[model samples]
Target: MVSFGMKDLLTLPITIVTGVYTALKFIYHCFLRPLQSGNSQKTRLDQASLFYEGQAGIYDATRGGLLRGRHTMLALSASHLRILRETAANKRLVWVDIGGGTGHNIEFMDDHFPVSSFDAIYIVDICEPLLQVARDRIAKRGWKNVTVLCQDATVFWLPEWLDGIDPRGSVSFVTMSYSITMIPRFHAVLDRVEHVLAHETGLFGVADFYTAEKQESLIDRSIGGLDKGCGWFRRWFWRIFFEFDHIFLGSARRSYLEHRFGTIKSLNGRNHFLVPYLVQIPYYIWLGRSRFRDNYPLDRSLELEYVSQESPGIPVEDVPLTPFHYSITKHWRVPYFLEPTHEKFHSFTRVFTPEDSMELIRHLEVSRDDSVLFVTSAGDSALHLAINSRPKQIHCVDPNPIQGHLLELKLAAIQSLEYEDFFALFGEGKHPTFRSLLDSRIAPYLSAAAYQFWKRDKNNFSSSFYLDGSAGQALAFMRSIFGVAGLSKDVIAFCNSDTLVEQQPIWQRKIRPVMCPTIAFLLRFGWRVFGIPPNQWKMLLKDGDVSAYVRDTLDPLISKYLLKTESHFFHLALTGHYTPQCCPEYLTRAGFERLRTNKGEATDAIRLHTKSMLSALRSLPASSLTHIVLMDHFDSSETRGS
Candidate 1:
């Protein structure tokens, strides 16, 4: 129907043109479009709900090799299963592998603990092909206890989700090893977990793609894998695909837990580090200047217009505790290096406590009590302890007014509202009274940091980050607590692993073989010795070298005093471990005073409080304090002394 000359040949038929364009478009999309694999996960990648459904063929053909330490993950999870089920005095538990195909995870655990009698095992996943792979892999070894489910993990109310499972502690421990990175909006999944997990009793075993920091460290390791034809494209492709997961997506775990649970046990369970990208470090920021003329601008989330609504019109109410979904690998890498505080960790005896208040009120001690001032170096708890004790005058000063406000509000919710009701709004069980109390007297002087953490992202399902702006101080404090997990133990471990995200590269390739095996062995042995899970081991060790870099690098004074028991950091507000938020702050002397530092202000007079150290009682004033509670827990006398 179409004979063409040279000119006519240039002009193709509409059908032919359309077909060629369609084919090229497909090829481009498959290779380049982020929807195929992009850094910005929040954006819709394609018209289809299944993000990578069509690309499944290529994904399988070149899905990156088993992630580094995948074997260890299998081994660690299996070991845990063995210790739990087979071992006689263990905490009987159930295993739930979310996104677990047929049984790569459960199979190993089952093989090891075969006679152990598992309570139950649930393998949940979405893709049928993976499920098929899981099924085929699992069939190699039979597991009567395992049950596979091909279903959407986001479905909160799947009757079969945990129907067949039960545990000794009445828990179904869920593990998401390297799978959560695939989830785009993982918050809903978290909400489901919170609702499903039995209250006060359940271990959530989580591991995922490494953080941005780890990934950066691994780029070189990957290079070794690459230059040697070790599959660079696979590593780089998946690594790039996970860029958002390492930073933005994973960041939600911190915010989610704080918003839902109040305290951060682990942003992926390793208690040592504080994630920075989300932590608000002093990095180069690239944000556009706001175009709005008004001081307060509204956010556009599903619609064209919506105000912060923290506005007066709505009559502000506290948000109820809503469980968020953000599962992190137990491996943490934030606050750099952190240690759990030693004994008496949570035992900071507030001068305002009921028992202590009476002591101040008694006898000749009250003779000059006319100027009885209450200074809190504590967080929100100060108000309750102060008001309940009927302090003659309470001058609660906090460098961060937000903490003061929270304390104040906590005091109010305690006074006017109910704690349970307050908990509903904030999801935290501690004193709900702090919010209303803050609304009244304390709201005026909210700290700059607190305002940003609490109010800036109101609709966001996350925790407030007081550690970002004050990270330098927080880092200084963290090193003081957790004794660098015996890093020699860590480094030796690094040398033994098969595939670690190596940091340095040798100039000579011949030198490579020696380094690889040495590093691999070090890694393997470290986990074996320390009794740390593979997930946790990765969190602490960087480039297979776990020597506490951040902690050891602190100013010499901080490094020495904080770790050694001689320091007063022991009797402070550490959540059972050393953390960034626990350290003392020079910024909020008033707030720190109210929370009441272990010793009074670093005033010139009390500077001699230290018994052994050269440093004097530094930071505040003795005049700032009106009373002190002396508990004789020290060595010399029966009671403990500071």
Candidate 2:
């Protein structure tokens, strides 16, 4: 019901004209622009200049949403550089940004690491227009350490090298943000990168659009963890879509980069910022170091010295090198074959160790010189060893891959989580923000398998991580039995008892008579839930009746130690969770602080192996272990034969 006047009619026409003009301008400058063809044999630089001449001014505004992972790439590089700076405090730190258009990446880096901290910063690109914009940015920021270079990335050199002095192995960091795919002859550029990067401390970071095949080689899968393959449609669609702008998204670029460097961390993601977030573009961020530097030969005398310190009688030279000895991160975990038919163990078998860890620590007297290896059952023993004794090294071996995943989650929680969050996760077995913490903070330190496992099963923490495993199910069964028999109050009272004297009366009057009989009968059918095989059950039967064995074990633990403050094993069994006063040592505030201090020195010393104990021992260097806590596994004849 509205009528337009002459001014309103004119305003509508003007607005329409402005919208059309802006759209045409953006399309012409970004997509429809013609290349400068003065000569048929134009160099790569000439083409790059022509492409950016009209788009440089509007580049940042137009492409801001399209270019993803720029910030993540820079932040990851900064983290590695900060770590490297600790070791090379006396040396000058340099950074080179290849194809760094308009100095946007350098400016964004200020949010993560200050730009002035670098001794020198260079922005190398083939486009003069972009370099000019970068120069303006540097001047506006008043940064004397920054430089804008209009040169090809392959032939670029530091200013010091121009004086006829070779500056090989001097640069500390090199980054390529969304530029590797645009470069012609990227192999030569990658080769030149190795020549200029420091042999030992250099780090290379890159993020760009890529297309991978549906299947990759075994070697690629092993070396490049989490670098997954793309679907056929996506791989084909993005490659053809980007080729119109002369940007190549082939898989060869990423493969060659991995071949040239040892991968420290690699992540695959999708860019979903285009076309109202419906179109997804595949991309990757890679952090790497020199492969040659990582695989350098070990000193024979030092190797023998380390081995003989732990085990004096074995010869070092006789132990051949295994694949476990050579890893990019120097961790003991290696790629192993996963059986297709095997059903994975998705929960903890033992909620707590049957063999007392405190008693083991007291008797074994684990010292700084000792290197201990033990089963990673529920990760209690290894964590106990790591906290109670700061041993030189601790190896956690388990054939069940999910068990290894659980241990990794525990270690990562110790490293990245605070005391309160740690308590909520392991003590109460429920955390609300576990998914967010796992994605942002914990993903970087975990392996691909571990990360994927936790990502899928993160909801386990939403209810109760302890209540989802087989051991948890068994505990639930026991609690249900207590509820039906109206003995839950007595059990709670027994766990709350301050001294053994208070516990003995409660156990003798109400708990033992009911629990002992029920346990003896349930032990036969429920042994598998507790991870007890038939052979182990048979061995238990050889000594005495199940009722007597149950009575003997429970009576001593209850009669000797205070249940509320002294014993976490029976406490967790009685209740579904542990109290702050009665829990594993690693769950204590002092223990968590000790493990979290000094960049997690205690947790860092532990290595996880997803293999049999015998296989792990065979792969280890001769005499590298000082103590071996086989636990009750040696009680099984099958294990003893192995």
Could you give the C-alpha RMSD of every candidate to the true structure, in order shown?
A: 24.0, 8.2
Looking at model 1, report the run of 10 residues with the lowest lDDT sum.
329-338
In model 2, what is the error at residue 236, expressed in angstroms? 2.6
What does candidate 1's lDDT look like per residue over 1-642, in tens digits?
976687666666865776576555545545555543444522332322243454433433332232333333343334333323333335444556776754566644554345236566667776565566666655666656666776666662333444664322244456665565556557766565555553433435454443222222221111111111213443355455545323233434423423333111122111111453332211110000111112212122211111132222432222211111111111110011011211112212221111222233343152223223232323222233332233433333322333232443333233223333433332221233343333232222222122222323323212222212222123223323223433332222222222222311211122223323433444455333322345455555744444333223322423233221222233121221222222222112243343333322111111111011111112223564464332221222232233
TM-scores of the models, in the order given: 0.31, 0.72
Best TM-score among the predictions, by candidate number? 2
Q: Which predicted model would earn the best lDDT?
A: 2
Worst 10 residues of 2 by lDDT: 319-328
- Model 2 residue 636 CA deviation (Å) reads 8.6
Question: Model 2, 1-642: lDDT tens per residue?
Answer: 898799998799888887676556768966788665432325566778878887677777667778887876777677557666767888878889999979999888887789989899999988899898999889999999998887778788778678775678888899999999998779989999988888788889898999887443334554444436888998888898887677899989988888777666666777787475578888877777776664444333433454466557775443222222232222434445333322366556665565678778888888989999888887887887888888998988888878877877777777667899889988988889887666455544555556556765537689756656776787777888889989999999999987777889999998888788877877877877776767878878897799899999889988888989988878888787788999988899998888778877877668787777888899789999999988776654365766
Q: Which stretches of candidate 2 lie over 4 Å from their true place?
A: 1-66, 128-142, 163-165, 214-217, 271-280, 294-355, 363-371, 386-393, 405-564, 569-580, 592-607, 620-628, 632-640
